[model samples]
Every structure is written in structure tokens, then in C-alpha cells.
Target: MERQADWRQEKAQALARARVVVIKVGSAVLTDAQGLSTPVLESLARQMAALRTAPDGHERRLVLVSSGAVAAGRAVLRAHGHSGETSGLSARQAAAAVGQGQLMRAWDEVFRAYDFPTSQVLLTRDDLRARQRFLNARNTFAELMDWGVLPIVNENDTVSVSELKFGDNDCLASLLVNLIGADLYINLTSAPGVYAANPQEVPDAGILECVEDVAGLDLGRMCGGKTSVGTGGMYSKLQAARRAAQLGVPTLILPGREADVLARAFGGEAVGTWVRPEEHAIPRRKFWLAYQSDPAGTVLVD
Candidate 1:
């Protein structure tokens, strides 16, 4: 018990000192049967605003990588009398095209209530895979952060075909962590944290509070597949966390709908599972060359 307490304190201190944080909210957390949850969004916006200007007067840079365009798109489609399952790729893409604006508009209005300005950024895999484009995107993010504008990012679903998609926003958020040199990555999802078994299937599944070595654990069996509304699942989250760990960035997987969840997590409340990173940072060039680039072929050594 004492050891757990110590770990929580350590993580809280690290989070408090982090200068830049990347927050990724999943579709399951952002949307419901009716579509976007205004209450949840408003609560999140209020907390983010408070975090920006804390009572202690310390300011932290924030980047939000959010998912829910397709869900929002579904709402738009329904409103327009296009009623059918949005499971097909084309239908999903169409939903994204129509809902992207709605998603950004909702976010903008909520943030605007707090007098905060938000910029919408849409990206595809090719955008980051290419060296020149990657640098350009990085510069844009840097400028936005410098200007104190919260940049809200989403996958360019409208133009992204199967070949171009990043698979899920979890992967995109992980890449953004390295792209922007984020100090911390927060993945807010439906569940409180990673569980020993599928919580939905098992009524009494227990949560894993702290994970020091992701490689040593079997995350595949722990995290099941996708949900009804979201593309990625717990498996993708663990994969993203592992990638961020390689970049020397710790990740926190927590419940998004919890009241004051973000603030509480940073305040050292131990509300989620913490994935610790390596002590040394991986060289930026090496990371890009290994993961981002599409190598022609591989050569084996004797």
C-alpha cells in the first residue's frame, strides 16, 4: 500500500512538472447513442481552461488529439434523412466529411466560452511519413503553441482511404507525442484504465494501476478489439503507450467522463494506469527512420 502511494506521488510530481502535454480523447468517451455529449465536452473544456491558467500561475502547453468525427458525421447524416449503418468505409468517410466541421464547431464553442481559441488540424499518414511535410507540420504546431492557441487535431477521414488511414487516432496521438516532443501523453477513454480482463465481458475485472515495463506484460489478451463507435480499442492504446515510451514520454490511460479527471490526475490523485518510459530519450532521427519511413527492403546480418 505504501509502495503504491509512493508511485502515485512520483507520477503526480512528474505530471505537474511537465511543460507540454498531449491529450487524446477516444470516440467512446466523446459520443453516445445520441451522438456528441455536450456535458462531457463542456466539463473537459472547463478543466483544460483551468489547467491553462492555474491558481499557482504556472502555464502548461496542451495539444488535443480527439476522435469523434465519424460519430458526429453519423448525427449529420441522420439529420439529413440518410438513415443506415455507418459501418461501410464510404459511409464512414462521408460522415467524417460532414461531421468534421460540426466536431470542430462544438469544440470551438465550448472553448470559446472560456475565452480560449482553438485551431483545427486534420492529418493523414502521408503528411507525417514524408520528411518535408513532417517538418512543416511540426513548425505549424510549434507556432500554434507559441501563440497560446490550443490545437485540436483529427485524422483527415474525408481524404484518407484504407491505404492512407493511420488505422486509429491512438496511433496518430502517439506520433504527435514524438512529433511535437510532448513531455506527457494522456489517453482518456471509456474505461478507468487497463484491466486484467475485458471489463465489459467480465463484471469484476480489476484495473492495472501502474505499468513499468510494457514488454513484460501480455497486453494483447488483456485488451480486446474495437467498439461499436470507435475504431481502436485497448490494444491500440497499449501499442501507442509503448511507442510513446520509446520516445521517453510517459502515458496515462484514464476514464474521460470522470469529473475533474484531468486535473485530478495531474494533481497526484492516482486515478488511472501510468505507463513509465525509458530513462534515455531515443534520437529523433532514429525514431523517424525506424517507424515513420517506408523502407524498400530489409537486409539481414550474419
Candidate 2:
């Protein structure tokens, strides 16, 4: 029990000391059959507001990576006499175009109510692939943080094609961790944490609280696939955690719908799975180049 206590304390300290945090909210947590959950957004905004006023007198910088454009678009489409179950890339793109604005509007209203300013930042994989563009994006984020403006980042789904897409917000969140050198990466999902098996299929499945090495685990089989409304599942979250760990950024995956989830998480409560960073940390510039930068060409040398 002493060892466990030490582990818990260590995680609490890591969370408490995190000056810069990147939070990614999945579509499953943000949306339902009807539409976006105002209650959830309200709670999240409150927590974010609280985070801005740290006890240590140091201002915390936060960046939110939100996914729900497609789901939100579907609701808009349904209201316009279009089927919510619209298929095909073009149809989904159209939905994203309509929903993106609505999604931001909802976020803006919620944050504005709390007296917080938020800026929308839409990005594609291609945007971060080029060296000059990557640096430019990094500078933009720095400026936003310096100005005390919270950036709400999302994939440019409306304009991005299959080849240029980041695939899911999970990957994008991990890249953001490196992009801004965030101290912590929080992945708020529908489920509590990583499970031993599918809880739906196995009634007695257990949650793993601490994952020291995500690469050692068979996450694909353990966590399974994507959600109905979102492209990423538990497996993608684990992948994101591993990527963040590579750069010495710890990641926490927790249930977003829980009452004061963000507050409880930073308050030293062991609420979800914590992926610890590796002992040897990679240089920020090197990590960005290796992971974020797209390779021009591969030359096989003997």
C-alpha cells in the first residue's frame, strides 16, 4: 500500500505542477443523439476558468482540442430536412462545414459567460508537415498563450481530404503536446479509463489506473475500436499517450461527464489512467522534427 500511495502522490504532484495543459474532449463525451450537451460544456468551462487562477500565483495556459464537428453538423442537417445519417465524404464535409460554426458558437457562448476569451484554430496534417508552417503555427500558439487567450483547436474537416487528414483528434492532440511543449495532456472520453476488456462484453472487466509503458500493452485488443460518433477509440487514446510520453509529457484519460472531473483530476484525486513519461526525455525540437515533420523522401542506404 505504501508503494501505491507514493505513486498516487507522484501523479498528483505532476498534475499540480503542470503550467501548460492540452485537453482533448472526444465527440462521444461532447455529443448525444439530440445534440451537443450544454451541461457538459458548462461544467468544462467552469473548470477551465478555475484552472486559470492557480494558488501558486502562476497563470496556467490551456489549449483545448475539441472533436464534435461531424456530430454537430448532423444535427444541423437534420434541422434542415436532411438525414442525419448522411454518408459519403462529400456529405460529411458539408456537415462539417455547417457544424463547425455552430460548435464554435456554443463554445464561445459558454466561455464568454465565464468571462474567458477563446479563439478557434483549425488545422490539417499538411499544415504542420512543412517546416516553415510548423514554426509559424508554434509561434501563433505562443502568442495566444502569452496574450492569455485560450485556443480551441480542431481538425479542418470541411476542407481536408482523406490524404491530408490527421485521421482523428487523438493524433492531433498528441501533436499539439509537442507543438506547444505542454506539461500535461488530458484526454476526456466517455469511459473512465483503459479497461482490461470491453466492459459491455465482459461484466467483470477492470480499469487500469496507471500505465507506465503503453507500448508493452496490447491496446488494440484490450480497448477495442472507435466509437459510433467519433473516429478515435481507446486504442487511439493509448497511442496518443505513448506519443506524449515520448516527449516527457504525461497523459491522463478520464471520463468527461463526471462531476467536476477536471477539478478533481488536478486536485490530486486518482480518477483515471495516468501514463507516466519515459525516464529519458527527448529534445523538443528533435521530437517535433521526428514526429511532427513529414518526411520528404526515404533513401535506403546500406
Candidate 3:
């Protein structure tokens, strides 16, 4: 395929082989400044439920890596009169405690509507970075898949120290794509995708159609919309999608607010910027090192 090829031409071919897909939902998409958008979450869940009932649905499995507990939790805390003067760590942990229940309730309501069982799996960075923990996490998801249950994962923010946190689900999304060996990774965000200039800064910023390499891209100039409940911006998402693509897992960076975008992606339509997977899945050790290898410290290449 040409570097700039309209992926639509290959949608059928792509979807045919896409058996496992990972979706990353950022707080911007799942919550308003105050808290969770029950209706939007319901709508998204309905879409996913609809997909599961599709003819080929049984052949495919979908995993959701969601971020919103902190955002939602903060709202709950504020509603309960928690002081805004709390430390960042205190606020996040408090919010997570309050909102995790609400988040699960919303997802449960939707998934149950279709008679699908959704199980929650809270993980810390250690779960992905530690080899033994990694295998255990994978096996649990594998078992869930075997039993026809959709595994819903989120970072264990309530107890995780800062360094232990994946920081944002964008990075978690990328790492999860590798963890699950997903065929496609869909990263749903508030904005559409990567742009040459920050969309807010540049009125005419255009979404790049496909990303072949982000290592050479300028990310310093990119900033997130500063959603009240979340800390990730498109820059983190670009980092996520690029990492997933490098693992030979195709990723789509699409606007979460757009109706039916996730469904369209699964249907093999060009929904947003596409980060095509590397020509092939890199070998295990190299992929593990590059995808999951711990960096002792920052090192810039000459």
C-alpha cells in the first residue's frame, strides 16, 4: 500500500484479520468538567454491545482500557465538600475511591443490557513491567476471553505511587496493545488526532492522515485541552499510538465525541488518523525491550 493510501480501500482486508482490538478511553471523552457523562458512556457501551452481537462478533474480542476514575472521583469529592487544597496525590486517590464505583456502575448497566459480562481488572505498572506479573495478567485476560467475558482494565491509581502509575491511559493503551497482542488498537480522545500545530494554537491545523514515524515529530509544541478531570493530551496519545504501531498493532486515533467512530473503526472505515503497524510484528525480546523495557534514565541518541 502507498504511504498515503486511503485505508478504506483495505478496510475489508484489515477487519477480516482483526480478531482482537484494544480501546483506550480518555477522561475527556468519558467525563465532562464535573463528572461522568452517563448518556455518552451508555451510547458508547451500546455501540460496543451492538458490535458484540454482530455476525462476526463472536469471532472477535474487545478490551477496554479506561481512564476517568480520578476525574469522576474528583467531582464526587468536591460534591462531598472535599477541599480543593488537597495535594495532587490525595486528590487523585480520593477521586478514584469515589468514582471507580460510579464508572463501573455505568459500564455494568450498559454491558448487562446486552447480557454481556464485563469484569474489572485494576493493574499497576508493575503488572506490565514485571515478567511474572505480566504473564499472570495475560492469563487472566485469556481466561476471560475463553469464558466470553470482556475484561475492563484500569490503572490502580488509588494505591499506586506516582512512578508506579502508567501516568495516563494513553501510555497504558499502547502498553496494553502489546500486553494483549491486539490486532487493532483504537485510542479514543477528545480531539481527532495528531496535528502539525496544536489545534488550539493553529486555527487551520490539519490532522495527519497517517503516522509512519513519531520519533522525528515535534511533540514539545503539543499540549492537551486540559480537561478538568484528566492529565493526558494528544501528545501522550501520539506517544501511545506510535508505540502500539511499532509493535505491529495497527492503531486508530479518533475523536471520542464523534458518534459511531469506534464502530466505524471496527468496520474497517477510515475514522481518524491511522498509525499503521510496523511492516510486521517485531520479534519477542526486541518488542519486549522496546515496548516494555525499563529505561534506567533518559538517553538521547546522537
RMSD in order of candidates? 2.9, 2.5, 3.6
Q: Give per-residue lDDT, candidate 3, residue 119.
A: 94
In candidate 1, residue 280 scores what lDDT? 72
- The segments of candidate 1 whose C-alpha lies over 4 angstroms from its true place after superposition are 1-6, 54-56, 200-202, 297-302
lDDT of 3: 0.77
For model 3, the stretches where C-alpha displacement exceeds 4 angstroms are 1-6, 10-12, 53-58, 222-226, 267-269, 291-302
lDDT of 3 by residue, 26-94 (tens): 888998866888878877888776655445545678899888887777778778888575346876687
What TM-score does model 1 achieve against the real structure? 0.93
The residue-by-residue lDDT of candidate 2 on 1-302, one tens digit each, is 13344557768878778899999999999998877889989999999989986668788999999999888999877887886455688888888888899889999999998888999999999888887898899999999999989999999998999878988999999999988889999999999888878776777988888987877877756877689999999989999998898898889999999999989888877788888887677898888788767668889999
Residue-wise lDDT of candidate 1 within 1-302, one digit each (tens)?
Answer: 13344556668766877878899999999998878999999999998888785445678889999999999889878878989987888888888988889899999999999988999999999998899999999999999999999999999998898777899999999999989989899999998898978776787999889887775678766777887789999999999999888887889999999999988886767688998876676887778877787888889999
* Candidate 3 TM-score to native: 0.88
In candidate 2, list every pair of residues with a backbone clash.
none
- Best TM-score goes to which candidate? 2
Report how far off residue 31 is in candidate 1 (Å). Answer: 0.9
Minimum summed lDDT over a 10-residue window in model 2 is located at 1-10
